[model samples]
Target: MGTSAERTGLPDTEGISALPADVPAWRVLLSYVRPHRGALLAGGVLSLATAASGLVLPLVVRELIDNLGSDGPVAELVAAMAALVLINAAIGALGSYVLHRTAESVVLEARHHLIGRLLRLRLSAVERHEPGDLMSRVTADTTLLRVVTTDSLVGGVTSVLALAATVVMMGLMDLTLLGVTLLALAVAVVVIGLVVPRIHRAARHAQESVGVMGAALERMFGAFRTVKASGAEDREGDRLRGAASEAWRASVRAGKWEAVAGNTGGLAVQAAFIAVLSVGGARVASSAIEVGTLVAFLLYVYYLMPPVNQLASAVTQYQVGAAAVARIQEAEALPIEQLGPLPRATDQPIPSPPPRLQPTGTTSAPAAVTFDRVSFRYDPELPVVHDEISFAIPPGGMTAFVGPSGAGKTTVFSLIERFYEPDTGHVLLDGIDVQAWSLTDLRAAIGYVEQDAPVLSGTLRENLVFGAPGATAEEVERALRTTRLSAMINALPDGLDTTVGHRGMKLSGGERQRVAIARALLRRPRLLLLDEATSQLDAVNEAALRDTIAEAARTTTVLVVAHRLSTVTLAHRIILMDAGQVRAIGTHRELVTNSPLYAELAATQFLATAG
Candidate 1:
């Protein structure tokens, strides 16, 4: 099987922790806008109309001023000016509402895409990245896109158009005043351009630092009980504080640059307003322009300030948004599993499929598993875990694997499940390459209980039905009875519906193990792989579950990885492994007499007696 990185054509993330800058930030920013273009366009049109009304208001006021002493109706002129003011106010409010609403939609779409991508990411890729850092990208980073799509994208266009129109209106009144305003604004542009790139770098660092803080906090919570037992609360708190302080430093730096850009625009606009006023007053005194024209041009100069300031703000927002987009793009670039047929993302709500009816009985024909000279290692730098090892298990039998720590025992289970592909050679199921089988179907045929027997946070029923959502009531009862969990469930406050705390913490270790086994059993798989599945069970429960396993072997292939001799003594065959190779294959009695390692392990660890 091809490695996930090779198959997906994504660079192995093991060595590349930094965000790649290969894609242009602008292109990433535009991609987000493409999906919401219709809404953005509508908001932009409204914004433009608002600007148009503002532009016309000055002209209306100018008309009122010029006709003050004329025979024309003064009351009518006042009414026209009043109407323009109300129109401008109403349109501006509506436009703002539209833009803000669209901004929220952009955020929603980004989060949906990002969450979907993260969930489907390859296991290797996920293991390489921190969970909290990925979470920061989903929450904080996606939030930044809202402002970028609205203010930086659509609002930026509106500001530019309005600025252009205001300049034209000023020109019609007086070219001299327009030139003065433009010259003053030019210096601010030069200053702003010099610092804009710095904002992007600063903002990127700030976001990265926040992720670091989140990672630190998550680490503490994951081992909360251990930290308390070890009395390392103060030490861990200091570490979290250090991460937060670093984030604070980076955020302050970003804010400083943004303030500089925004303030520079305000300063430039104010200077331009003063220059326009001084020039227009001189023109009015010289009679080169009428008092009404001078007043109107001054109003136009005042109007120009907002758009100019807005343009500056938009640029600064883009820099911050681009930093976030770069981080988001890096996460999206990680390799993802190509699990069998799934739905493409869409805006429409997906209707849930009707519950699938599962057969009440276990599979009639058990599956045969084979490993063909397979070699594997988790990483290139690590020592090989399996060195050209080969093994086979026929259908419908109980087999046990016994090995010392680091002897590649659990790796066998992983290989069978294709969690990590073999570095060389093949793993086959019933003579067909496992890689060739559909992942969904291949997994459906195998029931795996991991070494930890992890249980998710949910109700007792949810955990039991996780692997088989459609298991019939009778099947559920049978599994519970087989696992000796009937008494525990009957005693619960809500029976099967009782809530199990996080990681099933509310249940005892042994009960959690039973829940995990029962969950797998509900699937009625042909090949059942149990890795230390009964390690936590007491003697009575262990013997009962062992009998259940012996019975299950009659109908399915049962493979167990165990250290206890009692667990494997009755197996039809046992494979003893040492260092990455199979040392001996025989019944427990045959191995006890023939293999020195097996005899030593049985006598020392398993407390076996040679009767």
Candidate 2:
């Protein structure tokens, strides 16, 4: 849960390392390449052959030039030169194709591992990061690996082979000229080394700034309606624009450093080319070297230019990709949730067992739910949300928790559903410690409907079966009838097949609530937890909703966290809370007389004066 800054691998321009930190970037890059090494090695060998063939082309041309009018067959020399040219072009194309395909395969591998880890990450880990920023890592960051594997890594490799071959050949032709060439290139190397780290820093800053911008945009979109209604569009726009400007500035800075490095490399290689020619020309004039050999050495000098320039470009591209890989590494560093008895992440997928619900049985069993001195806080630094508070709801009855906002009423349901764990005390369900039960089984045994009563973007049938994937058609009809949704479904043009828009925005609040209710009922859960399920409904729908809760309680336990007291006045038992403590627990009529806080809430929130 520490900051990403503490672990992000962006301090240097080196590639991402999947191994331990001591192993270094080269080894890390090799690990990703190792999977596709066969293809990469073939491509690299072919690329080396292409460079070698290119060197031979100049030799063929030099031979043609020296033997133009000689007794030697000129037609055969021209044919040989033509063949080398075609061979160079063909090998270059084939090598590039193989490397490019390998890069794509690497990207797929990285994404699959990243996504699997992301989906299995603990809820707490997910909560600490922004959805949009994480999405940027999954998508934008993964794309950068392609350039790293293909252009930067492979290109650097082939450039080294070409540079080494060219240097060796140049040395053999004229050692003195090669020495001068090396001295000139050394100045460029010093200049490049000085700026490489700066380029890395700039690129990392740019990528991080872009991630911040993405997070800002996600925040704006998530609360778009609120922003418009509050007339805060200008404020929000300025905030997003500020984040964008930061990214732009960092990118421009990175580009400036990259340009400096590229120009330095180009100028150095060009200077070396000129120096080699000047030295070789003088040597040739004094009969120290042959004219044909000088021409071939110059061809080697030209060949040296591309590898040097390519190495420079590759280094710059590598810094950019390294920046992206750093971001991806930060995301992958988090621990994934232990899905079951066995971990979910592996080279081969593990088959997950079906959720086993606790069987509903004899009425003489312990209470369906119990909280023993529970204490919780969303953040350790913040005030406690639940303070050593405890309560129990027996089976087969509607129990309502009526309280003001921030009283931790809704938190109780969250604890039971285990969206989070209590920091200090135990939460039990049907006499079993919840910590001892399987997360899948514990959740499968309870059905939860949030305050918003979220409906997914899918067909009615899909939503109905979401909680209970294996629910039967008869089960669906039974839930619909109980939730009083059968009438609504019959009126729709597509009935159960009707498409619900995003977050079920296509349906009214009442309809969405009913859909959530039906979905929960279809699961045949032993306990139903409803958090302000009727808070947004009109009087008629609220009344219907209360009746529906009552109907559901006939066979199962119903726990209600009520915002409006009238919705749960008829509950078998009422627990009144204030701040994070239960103030009173009894029948509504009993609490009305005993608890002053409950009475105040009834007068101010539950009962407004007659219209």
User: Which candidate has the highest TM-score of all?
Assistant: 1
| CA lDDT, every model vs. true structure | 0.84, 0.79
Model 1: per-residue Cα lDDT over 254-337, one tens digit each: 999999999999898889888878888888889999888878887887888789888998999999998998889889888876
Quote each prediction's TM-score. Answer: 0.90, 0.86
> Taking the tens digit of each residue's C-alpha lDDT, what string does model 2 give over 303-412?
88888888888898888887877777788776565535323212233223223433342222213888888899988898898999888778888899988889999989
After superposition, candidate 1 runs with Cα above 4 Å error? 1-21, 69-72, 340-360, 608-611
Provide the global lDDT of candidate 1 against the true structure.
0.84
RMSD values for the candidates in order, in angstroms, are 7.0, 6.5
